[model samples]
Target chain A: MNIIISNTAGTPIYEQIKEQIKAAIFRGELKEGELLPSIRRLARDLRISVITTMRAYNDLEQEGFVVNMQGKGCYVQSQNADLLREHKLREVEKHLHASVVAARLCELSDDELLNMLKYFMNEEDEYE
Target chain B: MNNILELNGVFKSYKTFALEDITFALPRGFVMGFIGPNGAGKTTTIKLILNMLQRNAGTIKVFGKDNIFYEQEIKEKIGVVMDNTFYVDEWSLKDIERTLKPFYKRWDSGKYNSFLSDFRLDVNKKVKEISRGMKMKLMIAIALSHEADLLILDEPTSGLDAVARNELMEILSEFIEDENKGVLFSTHVTPDLEKIADYITVINNGRILYSGIKDDLLEKYVIIRGGLDVLDDEFKTKIIGCREHNVGFDGLIDSSVLPLLPKNIITERSNLDEIIVRFNNWRENK
Candidate 1:
């Protein structure tokens, strides 16, 4: 897995790794049962601490993106459709919340905000 | 494991400045970016760690061993790249290799060749003939070729182009693939540290200003900007650095207090560069 972390980015290094790996799994870039690099190997490759890599792996496992087999290694887990849907929904909810807050700050009317959202959604769909 | 490197109540002095009660640690296999303005005792701390300079007070430990007691032993396993190129002007890369081969027990010529190729450095180029970027690359190549557990670099990217800087960062990323390896990268260049530093230690005037995981800084500090009318004396005191103009004031604030900001004020996440610049400015003003 190729991951680059920004020190200046608001996110922590471990979280960056976790998020990237999750995104890869969501995009089907990493398949189920595929062995992920060892925490040590990933740490060394990324030039980060082993603890940071381990934290990312732990987070990935907790989020069900990957499973760690003690003494063996970590591997991509079979994606749970329900869990995936829930995760995606949560992400959309977050975006909606942010958009609403931004709209409120801008003093945009509900109708105007809805129209902007719809326009963006249409653009996204077109891109897809 | 405890910290990979730790200094407890450390004190060192030069004719002009003194490091007072300095204490910090770098957890294993993590890159700790050491930052401070010039004359902030960054190099002094490094010298203490490397036993190149004696400390008047406190314990210095490397990989959990007492630094003074294990100086020779510790030196063997740690790779160091300083700001100035140490080689003679006339020496070639091959000369450097021959000179360093005996110093490191785990030195591998084959690995060195691979690094040289990776950095695209010519072995025949004299130290003085090589560009500044090439010299830094050569130092990094030599540093990584040895199976050192820790890499300590002092201002390795101070004067390189963006491309060269990124290349060095990439090489560092690749080098840390050995789980046991760690990096102590000291630089005033906050942007490069922002790219790869796992933890950051900021020092000023021979004392540690801050030390912790890079995320902590991002999550816990913010830059607030607003008109002078909106900034109260109470709020101003809480800021680490504040600059005022007739138009407005901008300052770094603790994130926890961000909620207390006046409605018109703007609060945003502060990048490493802004944080360091503000910090140094504050130090200078103080």
Candidate 2:
């Protein structure tokens, strides 16, 4: 998995790490049971504090994205269908919230909003 | 988990400078970068830790024992690399190791040899013939060869080139793989600490300015820039370290005050260098 960190970003280093790991998991680049680098190894490689790395790993474990084994290291956890669906739903909810705000700002009717979304979805599918 | 090194209310004084109530702790498996300007008591505190200088007050502990009470035992478990070299100028790498090996109970000859080769140092080269980087490598090789749980270095990268400095950082990062190992290196080069230090203890004018995780220190302060018009007495009162110039006003402000700040002021996350500069400024202005 590719992970890049930017010191200038407003996001804290640990948050950047967590977001990247989550994205990689969602993208299927990191498969279930795939071993992640040991905390020290990742910290050394990234030139970041091990505490920052530990925080990221701890968050991942708490979110059920990874499992940390004593002495062995962290591994990607198996994502059940329900968990995957829940994650996708949360992601969609964020977009839907933004879309609702934009629709209200533009004073669009329900039919107009639905038609615009359909047009964009079909446009994206044509490229895919 | 036990602290690898602990200092409690440490106080020391000299004719020209004094370190007052200095305190911090380094947990095992982490590297704590001790930082300060010249005459900031960084070296004095280090000397106190090694029991080289007597403290006027307070206690220092290594491996849960008083530094003075178990000085010899503590010394055995501690590896030190100072700016000055104690090796004879004419001695070769092998001679240097052979002379110093007897002092440490756990010194590994094989490990020393391997490190020497890994560092590309010739065993036959005289100490005087080697470069500054080579000398530092030799020192680190010796430090690691003893299997010391704690490595204390003062300005180890001061005189080295950029490439050499990066190499040393890589070596240090690798050295902390063992959960029992802890490193405390004092340096003015903040970037090095930004890269690998888990915790940073910044001191100035013989006083502790800040001591905690490296990330938190970076996050705690912000650099604010705006026009001179933004410099009101109320805002100026909140500035940690700021300067007003003909162009505009630039200052350091604590992150907690950001939300209360006027929207016109520009704020950016402060780096370790900015934090040091601001602290130095705050001390100077005070």
Candidate 3:
């Protein structure tokens, strides 16, 4: 796995690792039933604490994105269609919320921003 | 077995110096950084744990047994690499290993020889013939040669170059792969600890300031900087190490107070080195 830890991002190191791994799983870069690197080896390679990586793996397991087996290692859980859809929808809502706030700051009306988004959506089809 | 080493109310006193209420625990299968400035009791705390200096009070346990009461059994499973060497100057690398092998039941000559080769030390060179970094590496080689359950290293990377320091970090990561083993590494090289330490125990003025998870400690404080005009007495009281000059003001503040600050002031996450330096500034602020 290719992972780069950022020092200036303000988030804790473990959280950064957890988020990146979660994103990879969601994007299908990591396959279901595929083993993640052993916690110790990953730490050695990344030059990070083992506890930090262990926490990242544990958080993934807690959210049902992975399963950890004793003596073996962590394996990615197969994606649930409905669960992933809900997660993606929530992510879209978060982005739209930020867009609305930015539009308000620029004094753009709600309908104007909605129309802009619709135009952008149609603009993508020509390229495809 | 949760904690490999524990110190409860450990105190030591001298004519002009003392360590007060020193209490912390190194959890199993983790590296705990014992950090403090010079004369801040970092070395004294390590000495107490190793039973090198007598503590005026409190109990210390190594692997669940009292360090003093079961010194022999405890020492066998503990590997120590301090700043000073205890070997004769005339002893070569081979002679030193031979003399120390019988002390550890789990000593492996294969591991010793391999480490010596990896560290690029000549076995024929006497202790006085090598440089400071080499001597430190030799000490670490011996420490690793014995399969000790607990490794207590005091500033092992200070004199070493960046390459050697990186090597030590890798070696330590592999060593802690076993859940039964742990390390209590005491050093002011906070950057090294930032990369590999699971827990951080900060000492200042001979007292424990913070002891817990490394992330929690880093998340606790933030570096605040702004114009000198922003330095009001009320806000200054909340900061641990407040300072001001003609140009601007800067200090360490608890994150809980971050939201209360004005928009003009900016805050950033603090690192281990900044935390240690700011901790010393706390007394002056008072």
Candidate 4:
């Protein structure tokens, strides 16, 4: 899989690598059982620190999107369909969280916030 | 965790300058950027590690043995690339290698010859005849040929151009492909370190201001900028080496204080260069 990093993205480089790999996995570009590039090789190719790639791989492993085999290498996990759905669900939950904070800032009542959510749903439905 | 090199409370003194409480460790399988402004005891610290200079107090260990005790054993395994070479200036590359080859047990002539060709250095050229970048590459070639586990570089990238520096990074990344090898690279060129260094140890006036993972250190500090009017005493307290002008003021501050900043203030992530400069500025301000 090809991964590009942008220093100007305002996010840390390691996060960019992690998110890109996660996106690649979700897109089925990285198939299950496909071995990822060795951490040092990736760092060398990308001209980034070995630790940065190590961090990204470690994080992916911890998050269950990747698995490490001792002395073997990292590989994309099996059963990615449920994992993919779980990731998208987390994103939706995060946006809803931000919406709640924004609604609280505006001092909107619970009913008003619920009505706004309904309005958005209907708008999206009409577009569909 | 195995440490290739460790220094604790390593103190050294001269007539007017001194290094105190110099402590840091380079773990195996990574690179540590040894950074500081000029005359900040970086070279002195390296010298102490190499046993070229004596420390007044504290301990230094290389490969789990006291540095002084294992000086020869450690020297064989630790490659040193100082800003200048000590090889006879008139000696050709081949002659130089021939002179130094006997000192190393695992001197691979084939590897040395290939690296010289890869660097495009003529084997017949005298040591003083090559460019600075070539000289740097030659040192690295020698370092690698001897199968050194730890590479200590002092200002190795000083005179090299950006392309040369990037090439050096590639070579260094390849060098540490083995998990047992490590590097302690000292340079004023912070951007080079930013790309390849796993950890950073920032020293100033012979003291370590910060020493830890490079990412964490970068994440810890931020650049704060705002109009001079925003420079209240409370806000100023959080800033380091605050530079004030009629129009605005800017300085480095811990990211933890970002929440306390007002809406008018601007915050940006601090890079290694900015951090080092602001630190030196802080010294001047003090």
Clashing pairs in 2: none
List runs of model 3 lying over 4 Å from the truth: A93-128
How well does candidate 2 score on lDDT at residue B192? 78
lDDT of 1 by residue, A95-122 (tens): 8998998888778999999999899989
> Tens digit of lDDT per residue, candidate 2, span B1-286?
6899999999998788889999999999999999987778899999999999999999899998999999989998898989868899999998988899899999999999999999999999999999998889898999889988999999999899999999999888888877789999999888877868899999999999888898788888989999887688999988977888998988899889898987677778787778777779877998
What lDDT tens digits, residue by residue, belong to model 4 across residues A17-127?
Answer: 999998898888998899999998898888788888999999999999899999999999885567778889998999999899778767889999999999999999999
Superposition error at B6 for model 4 (Å):
0.3
* TM-score for each model: 0.85, 0.90, 0.91, 0.92
Worst 10 residues of 1 chain B by lDDT: B172-181
Query: Per TM-score, what order, best first?
Result: 4, 3, 2, 1
Chain B TM per candidate, please?
Answer: 0.95, 0.98, 0.96, 0.98
Candidate 1, residues B101-140, lDDT tens digits: the string is 9988889999999889878888888899988889888888
Best by lDDT: 4
Which numbered prediction scores highest in DockQ against the true structure?
Answer: 3
For lDDT, candidate 3 versus 4, the one ahead is 4
In model 4, residue pairs whose N, Cα or C atoms come closer than 3 Å (at least 3 residues apart or on different chains), thus clashing, are none
RMSD of 4: 2.9
Error of 2 at B264 (Å): 1.8
List per-prediction Cα lDDT, in the order shown: 0.84, 0.90, 0.87, 0.91
Worst 10 residues of 3 chain B by lDDT: B257-266
State the lDDT at B241 in candidate 2.
79
